[model samples]
Target: MTRGLSRRALLGGTVGGLALTTALTGPAATTATAATAATAATKTAGAGSRRGAVGPEPYVPVAVGAGGGPAGTDRVHVLKIGPDTAHTVLVLVPGMFGAAGDFRLLARDLVAAVPGVQVWAFDRREENLADRTGFATPDPAGYYLDGHYRSQDPTAAAYTAGWGLARTLDDLDTVVRMAACGGRRRVVLGGHSWGATTAMTYAAWDFDGRPGYRDLAALVVVDGGVRGAFKGTGQPVSDSPEQVRERLAAIDGGAVFDMTLSGVGLGSRAESTQIWYQLAGWYAHHDPAGRSVLQPRLPDALRPSSPLTNAGLLGTLVDVGFGWPNDISVHSGHLADADADGVRGWVDTGITPMSRVAAAYAGGPQPAVWEWYWPSRLSVDLDVADPYVDTDLARSLGLRLWHAEALDTPLYAFQTSYAKGTIVSGARDVVTNSRIPYGTYETDNGMTHLDPLFADTPHNTLTRTLAPFLTALR
Candidate 1:
């Protein structure tokens, strides 16, 4: 079952209900922050045990270093795979609020399919738990009271300010250099979702004519390297510094967009399942009134009834992260056992964040299942905080304002013609405006945003698609 949702439904609203009140409290809104986070959570409890959703092999940590902050306390982590004899390397970046584990399918397949070619993934300093409505401090354990993001140094540092796009690019540069091993290793930079944006930002950054990390290889954007500037609900926002500042300010203070409405953040597992069931009714059964099928009541004290409307769920589920590209949800065995089994499991529909909560409620909270997958905890501070309008990084990245001279590197992008999102359109604009040596601007048929990431077999669809293009890289 494949379905296409209207762009309006997909780009819901920016501020969630709880986020509004928190942003109103100003920067010193720590007290309100906790309540807001609690509200964002479908269920809650005391601290749970630390566990990994993915196993401890193939994906090995290559380097561990300190992340930049006032305290320099946050930890930076990088993982890699491929034979040492390999000359070419592909470095992948995860999307916003996405962890390194999400790329397990792509990384594993790349190593097996491509001979002597290495694949690497990094857990960005930005991939941290929200600290009182901001990033800079990582609270992976405290976020769910379970130590999921093990790379986070709990005692490392405290939040001083936002980690801007420049720092994020620097982190990517460091990872690239590490992967190169002090020598000029042929490297291709690619990213999924927001990571694609990060990769594009890295490619666009002016390296001052130095060829350390900026040597010619190729820029691979998988579904998200677009300069989605000034995209808002109801109307397109103007690309103005004042507008950007106001947007970031709202998020920094504490603005939460309803996940259901925003078509971004995920509700609890129960909520997700409710969302899935509702989607199944519409796409599977073709019900015109499928919008109100399976509305699940949640445990959040204030907004107990899930804000997830049938209209929003219908669109969000078709997205790569939230649901399968194909609208149908398969009964893929017991998904909750993945954490204990140490196996990568596909998160089927009907398993929302509340699934863990329900299990925890019935029994003790089971170990964090599906290490490979995590629900998005949309942070006003980290995820959508930076409205990239007229910022220095935005200019360097060729985001809002394109710089043709700055973008002289080779660029290749795979965008589905059915894409109603910013990535494809943005890529086209960037290619048109910049001096990017056009490589492959291929459009795939019937592939959803995540089809390139979550291909499940050894003969992976994504790796196979990129093989010919990557092989021809000079």
Candidate 2:
């Protein structure tokens, strides 16, 4: 039976976890960071893991560190692959707490179906959860958890254990250079969710002269939002941290919805899973209503999906660090302002922060299935209190910001008709914000956060689709 795709929401705001790392030596480190991640059993947890969903014989690849850099620059791992020949080399980047395996279909499809292209999904920087355990110290780097940002100056050093954006981009630069087949085979640089944000950031960084960050046929962004300065409003906020909390208390029916990496101190990976579990539960419950409209673009197969193993999840969230303005639930004002020309937008949405109590009832399944393999107590910092309040790291990451950068929408408008670049977006995605024609600056074929991956779902379609796009690049 051809099972229909499930209706899983994107990461559903559940941040696996993250912090910061310093081992970003060079392009080799970038290459090494994501190169040797342990590849899991494909059939166990892959793109087709959704219930009743059946199709390809679960594509997997065994990727070992073939050769690159000096003798022992980094280690190598393997991936599971079915039967196919790859002509194009794909460097798949995952968002916070994400792994190389995350890009199952994109990699599989492009490698298998997309003729003459070898797509290799990568496990980007600082995802290693080997060192620290049981809390971070209360230092400047420790207490500076801002809003959950996929692509921004990473401030969650103490919050989790992820790599810095600059390092990740740099690592990617070298990985592509080292593992790349050179001009013989074209390369496609792509990121999923925060991974896409990293892609855009890396693109900008490359344009800014980041070493090893170069030469790509095209960029593929799977269901990601643009972050920067706001466009319309330029006013500063009036509320303090306390004021922000109070604002949430006064929300209609005492409800607060937040999907930030903020406030997650030292707890079990359960808390990490709890975050998304609850959020996904919320989305699944609220899907009938128009409130959770942002997630409709997810592949139908993913909607009914179960929680993924929390193995390297924390490593993912720590990279971005926890902290955010209350914008996910309420109409946010963060990205409300943008010049589009200069990459600034308006922050009009008015989101609210969450209370300790609210998150409990709202969270979804806190799976303990992989406790044996992934471990339970990933990290903890009960000692590190907020500068203002003596709460946990969650509260520490939770600081209400007054100003944020809006994105420059039309900035990329010049890419099209000139460079073979076409924009991919879901109409329902709030990241598109209030475009005049509503997401038509480039090739806004109505894509959302999850649209970047789900080829066919609602207003979520990618004109540049992965396979052919990377194939043509060569």
Candidate with maximal lDDT: 1
Q: Estimate each model's TM-score.
A: 0.55, 0.39
Candidate 1, superposed: residue stretches over 4 Å from native: 1-73, 128-160, 207-213, 227-239, 251-406, 421-425, 458-461
Backbone clash numbers for all candidates listed: 17, 105
Give residue 421's error in model 1 in angstroms: 7.9
Tens digit per residue, CA lDDT, model 1, 364-384: 011110111122222221223
Cα lDDT tens digits for candidate 2, 163-212: 23333445566556644556555555666544554554444343243322
Candidate 2 similarity to native, TM-score:
0.39
lDDT of 2 at 465: 38
Error of 1 at 70 (Å): 8.4
Local error of candidate 1 at 26, Å? 50
